[model samples]
Target: MALTPDEIDGLRELILAVYGPVTEELLRDLCRCITAAGQISSGDEYKLLLAKSLAGADDVIADTLRRQTDLTDDAVEQLMRWAAEKTAPLEENESLRNIAEAYVKVTRKEVANVLGQLAAADVDGRVYPIKDVYRRTMDYVFREVSSGTKTPEEAVRRATLRLWQRGIRTVDRSDGRTFSVEFMAQRAIMAKMGEMTTAINEKHHDDGGCDGWEISAHSASAPDHEPYQGRQYSDKEYKRLNSRLQRRIGTLSCKHIAWPIKLGVDSPQWTNEQLAEMARENAKGVTYEGRHYTQYEATQQQKALENSIRQCKDRIAAAQEEGKLGSGELRSSRILLRQLNAEYKRFSAAAGLRTAPERLRAAGLGRALRPDGTLEMPRPAGTLTGSGGKLDVEEARKSYSAYLDTLTDAPEKNMVWLRYFTEKNPTEYMEDGTLDAPFAYDPVEDRILYNPRHPQFSTTDFEMANTHELAHRTDVLNAQGYKNKAFVDAISDASKAVLDNAEGFQRVAQAVRSDLMKDILSALSSGRLDTGFGHKAEYWAKNSEAVPLEIFAELFTMETRNDSDLFFVKKLFPGLWKEYQKLF
Candidate 1:
């Protein structure tokens, strides 16, 4: 495991006290990796070559140092010996330390000379492709930081700061004490670092299937602190913030150069054909009457269009207020607004963001009432959170009733009754949600749910069950929307690939359920342990399980801390529990 900053600092001090002085090379390697992703180039390359030779290579580190560069075999051998002698056993003998430091002093001078020569060659040579290859290699290097620490989340953020040479994303900007120096170095490297963008956007180099780059670090972290290795190459809409470093306009946005650079194209004047070709290449293949619009160009046009829409709205509002516009102009203005929103929606998928339709729907500022006494989208009690509505039972029951009424118009509109119950202790509730029964949906009964016992009747339990039931309804509708079992099978392979998708949901299903369960538990027992699991069972009915309501009650009875609560539910509810247990 990687040591914490405090732990590492302590180790460093102790090593210095015992050994007199420590090897600067190991510390330097760590600092170099943290300086800029580019700084770690040689070390990373060395590690890769070492890995390739893992099966058998006589002194792989030495071999790598010798073959990958012009360094003599003897010099490489000497450095390797010094590194090995100094890297570990810090709590052991001290006499060898003097010899190792002597070797390091010599190696440093040689290293400085070699790096100087490489820098000179880069300044005067064709290093574009070579730099691109190096950046891609660094991308892989950062992707593996997960292997170094249990807190992969922290590791990812740390690596991002170092990789970009920008501020560490972990400390929330202002919360740094010991980490501030590292964060500053990280931020400095990322600021205006254009070469890295050129490397990632190399996808747009030939085929132009790019819009533009937007860079954000990703996290590959498991809850128990394991490495989360997955996708590394970012999607297209990500912006390259250091655009000044990468000075080309997008394909569509290149309508007229906002600013032009003659750095790459050689001649001061650009041909019409050349400009058009460049723009098309950047347009990334979305043809407009067979002429492709470059991604850079499209972004510029989209921004201009939005500005035009905003102007139209201002003009119309002013005209109406001043009594200069007729009813016709007002109606036309509304239509224009709709069209602008639609355009945003169209580009949203490519932009990798929520479509316009989603934004409008979520605002919930508009509504329609059903004949059945339910509001279609009642102003949701200010976005559902872990803790639910007004804690008064009467008001909560009313809110729950309103929520049920709203769902009544939900297409299946068939009366969907789901109840949930969970254990009084939330940790236990959480443990069960994650482990024991991670929601097994039985589509046959049209019931979806989760229930943990509640010690007392409270808003938290009610909120938990309500969210779970609603989610189950969504799951059912989604399954029904599938074209055929075979198509769903294919989608499952691509999405919820691991589960083989017992039903038509992706990896997101388990996640959604978990959050919903948390909300349910959060809504109950604000500052105390609940008594039992009746409400949890009711929630299981609609959110976690597809089993009959009774079987769920039986399952809760079979596996829970409050067995007496099951008896209480059975005594009160009766027949349904016995019938449900038979399904097994």
Candidate 2:
């Protein structure tokens, strides 16, 4: 289990507290010395005073580091216990408990060694001795105050804010990257816990003599892991699967858990249908602020907001301790904190996600909220104009007739079919008066019906719809029925090509203006094209038999719209578009 937000906030507060009072006092004393001396100097008296001000900072930092290490150990132990209990049913002996104790012992030693080396924190990847940080901070404050760049109070406030914002950098990587002490600690603890849990589960499987393990499933699983979720695999198969993945199962940051199970004896946790439904639900994510966000994306957004709010609180606390409560920086930070909190709540509610208030908690700070003490609920995005409005049957007929009149240059055979169908089937309202099934063609009755008030019609112009229907009519007439082998083969070939060259197809999808095209392309890019086609393809392609026909009609409409769209269709499916061109 990941450390809850409250735990993380606690660690953050510890790190901030390390520098808050000490840094502020150092700045104040340095400014006073500079004021008396009229300028900062390297003389022995100045050096002596500076050394005296920073004398106990190292002890304070070391003590805080020890406390942070202890807290981290506690959090890791708790997480281990949680994992052990979760897998307790499968445990045959005290081995899991032994594993937990050993892991915690080893982890505590390792973390302590790492934190011990950090006698001074690094800022922006630059390690500084405690004396150097004080010297640099003092120099900066002196320069700003003496140069008229800032008043003494402003300079001290800025310096203190910077130190608090940077936090204590405890981990430096070979890649020349550095992370705050708490961040690295949390990451290491969680990673070790994951590894320990994986080892324990493997031991259980070995002890139970299970043939394989079943990977757990969850909504919005990482893209690469989604395919393997809820499925059981033999030992060899599981190893081979991991060999192909950049991120193996049960690795750090992966929430999936595996348990031992006899292949034939233990029932699968999820059926195929259930897994498929989970994938579909994940694909159909909620829209917030006019942009679609998958469940994973939504959670990430929430985390980001939480981080921002925490930072704001830390800054505000630092300012208050510095006695700059009325400073502009503090005022802006408080205002931003409120906005961030409101947004976090609204976004979670809109996305149908639960808000983790513990994650929003900031150590040593009260709740930050608007004056009304209530967060505003999010409203649904505005509805499209004319959506589900009344349909003027005669006007729709006239519109289609006028559209057909412009296609006189079309092939005689196609024209005859279109004109005949237009006369035989006058446009009429759907029985429900809404376009629940807008712009449909019934080949059995040789009928064409439309719902002009459909929301989709708000963006899709009439010419595109008419051309699409005409294309469908021509396909039926030429093939003598909807079961056209050549048509299906062409669409199948194009679809395969699209899948094979998904990146290129996405580029083409980007160039197209049609929302339908964008949706189809997005699905293709995400390996969900078939899923999209089955569920919410085009309005015309609702069933298996109709997919190819609807795709062809869609491409036909795209080609007829403008030269740009025609080029896109050609780029998307060169062979299919070429073959379709002969129809014109």
Candidate 3:
């Protein structure tokens, strides 16, 4: 709940009254003490001396508190709480000070009004009636003059003359109001307290991952003041605002405070069954690439796919404009677009959307009849390529043959077609193409893809990448006894022993045993690990489930780089490494 603007105005009015007298006394004490000291040259020196002076004003303090300003003790406490909540989010001392500075600036106008009243009282026998308003103080001043019981013109004239004497023309630039430092100090404290309260409330809700807040209006607040009072916004239709800009129970300055409401506590509307139903409807659990997504996660994944599809479309449009539509660039982009649209369709269907969940109309879907009744394949949109236009197939095949010659225990060269990607259509190429990994193996399809645009694609050591990808194929393809269930079971049994004996592998193995394996494998498969050799080594070694496939690839590359690495490779997988080396 937030304080309504009217309530805030009333509180400010009351606080101004209370603050004015105390402020005047404090200023008086500061001046007297500064004069006594006689040599305050610096700001720090002045503040130090001012602090000593304020400590001596016991009688003034008692008198200031004794004066009735219409604010109850409860109201004062509420203001303190408000101040705390506002400052609660600030963690650093410097950040808290910055917030305090902002509050001090806003409240300075009110401080100026109070100072004007005090100044007038000093000069004239009577004081000018004032409120802590920043703009149009004269309106309030004139209103006071007309409403007061006695000598309206006399009071106005005396106050006006006094103001003139001090050269205080406008409330904004009140050079005569010399007590700004003290005023700012008081406001800084109040602002920090309020900010702390905000931080506390936010931390609670955030930590719990709870939905919405329980808004309550002030007790004395009128019926028409805040209709939103006692309402909740936990539903999907209600979009939540950022915490600071979030609507409170009442308008600004209203003394309404909102508290975090745990789900199923005060919210009878949010039953466990309803939450489960929402999860089923919106976030229908999605499993992709061996990883499962919750309702929220599924929606987020769909958004990602949509974004990729859009970006791919933009790239396709740019390629057409550049007259590259006839090149492999267009075909590669179309291929990627096709893959993305397929995945997006699958996701949407799982989430229960109405659009047909089918493959995009592309080259593979049979031709539709022309208006003249001629049999024609419906060519891809915006394509200038002829029906038989081909990529540089011969060059890619040669590269694949050369790459295979370097592999020792690599699968048969012809087993997988090395489809050289001519255009790096960011969306499609490899499984984790964004990482720029040179090669990717699709085990289900038994195809090894070579990314021609990879940074290491043209390098002499490119065969190492081929070895890495080939490791995946070797495990899955029916080379000797490789593709059988028994082979996978044997690898699993062997991996258990290696994991038990390996240093730093047990903790990762333990993590893999828990529900964390999916997340770890996803990270590894996507190449999301931090860059650099050491980080890659640490990542691959730790992901125990992925280690079986990854270890061979990593060791193969390492052995190709230096023969010394073979000692460790043989030690790790004596039987497999020996067998794999025979293919070289």
Candidate 4:
């Protein structure tokens, strides 16, 4: 087979263009996978094995993973043991890498969040969680394919052509009593023994392992082994082709702290006080209304309002100051103060008071204090207001199950079990999306916010909205105890250090951005195209290698198409690539 180095570069560069630069570890892992493209047991080869192994029994995969990824030889042996037990996770990240494990956690959270959000996003609306099977299979393929052969286009052509050209066939070496190739190709490179063994589903008569599976050496093929497809894969041909492509996509996605967090300044020449004073000075030029307030009337109105409020408070004080005033006088002063307080409160809250009576009396009095500089104003408190009731378990389950029917291979998926595992999680706050996470926010409220809103292509809001929350979950709130402290601050500090170095540009967030974009692109490509995807495809391509990866976050962000889309499982991430645009 023929392939080229430039194609590998193009594919890698294109991956960056579409997905973004992968993380250091993932990049390293991909490098290892790609470099070992022609070599046996490369990344992609393992992935195929793992995929085939996991396609049937998930428990086996889980058990193997549980024993592996422990950073010890014993763990490796245990993993080997379990794989032999149920066939096994054949990929590097599958129960093999800690980051991969972490990734599963993050993605699982996304799945769970979609379910939770879907249940809560709508009250009386029909929703469908969109899914695409071909895209998923493509993901598995691309993730393990190696581009290190330096002949990607050629290799792709050859691999695609091989299926039709000479075709594949299996034979028996009656002497060795093993399954061998009936015909040999000009350059049939042997990549692995088991890859051929597994690919052909060749059961070794002498092989020993759990059930009817083969584990050890590929000594011979079983006599009862049936023919594969129209023919059998030559051990040499099978390994060569499988390993070639396997290594091609055996790319490991590395994750790192976002560039903004990494690029954080530790010791600037200007101190915090200096920064604050500068902010105050900057604030001086603008009036409260967010416009200019240089001349008389504008400033005068503010002054008058202050004076009026102060005068009201003074009246209240006076009633107490002089004992000559009756209870009626005190009542009148309190009412006057309240009216001034009401005016201020009205300005603060566009909505009328929803405050409890006890809070009203105290907060109302505090508002009166804002008039006089001497009187202390109470600090405004933020509330996590949300509207939703307990989920009708039956309805939610029915909707989710119905949505599952849209998928191609539902029975093989164990994710439904997870649905039974997690009931709906309550959303106590909205601030989590905007203010709660670390790094700079892209909110319209802040002038320094990186990007303004990019409208989604779909008329609905649920898909992206669902994905957006899940991204937040993965990015910031994945682990426990993050809510308890300023963890983002410390992480930001460290990430800032990483970003200061040139290597920081190749952080994990960048890779995730790339991975997601590629997945989205693949999802949109083979499956039904949404037709209305704007320049989002270009946006992802541009940010594929963006430095300071925080700038590329838009690549993975999603929003709901509508309230129903929020709660619907079918639409969770369903082929919505347009929403990723503008992060570049």
* Best by the TM-score measure: 2
Ranking by lDDT: 2, 3, 1, 4
The worst-scoring run of ten residues by lDDT in candidate 4 lies at 253-262
For lDDT, the strongest prediction is 2
Is 2 or 4 the stronger prediction by lDDT? 2
How would you encode candidate 3's per-residue C-alpha lDDT over 405-429 as one tens digit per residue?
A: 2222223332232222212211122
Each model's RMSD to truth, in Å?
27.3, 24.5, 31.8, 34.9
lDDT by residue for model 1 over 1-584, one digit each (tens)?
11122222222222111111011111122222322332232566646643433323223223333332232223333433422332333224353344344444454444322222210001122222222323333344444442443232333233322222211112222442222222222232222112222322342233344322221111111111111111111333123322432323221111111111123332334344544454444435344444454444454455456445544443333223222212354456656766775665566455433322232223221122111222222222222223432223333333353233223112221223221211111111211122233233344554432222222222233433444433343334432312234433332233233234324322223332222222222222220223222234345335322222223322322222122234422442344344433322
TM-score of predicted structure 2: 0.52
Per-model TM values vs. the true structure: 0.21, 0.52, 0.22, 0.17
lDDT of 4 at 494: 36
Model 4, 316-430: lDDT tens per residue?
3323322232234445756665676555554334222122211222322222121111122111111011123222333323223222222212222222321232224322222
Error of 2 at 444 (Å): 94
What C-alpha lDDT, on a 0 to 100 scale, does residue 396 get in candidate 3?
A: 36
The Cα error of candidate 4 at residue 425, in Å, is 6.5
TM-score of 4: 0.17
**Backbone N/Cα/C clashes per model:** 70, 0, 31, 54
Q: Tell me the lDDT of model 1 at 117.
A: 23
Sorted on TM-score, best first, the list reads: 2, 3, 1, 4
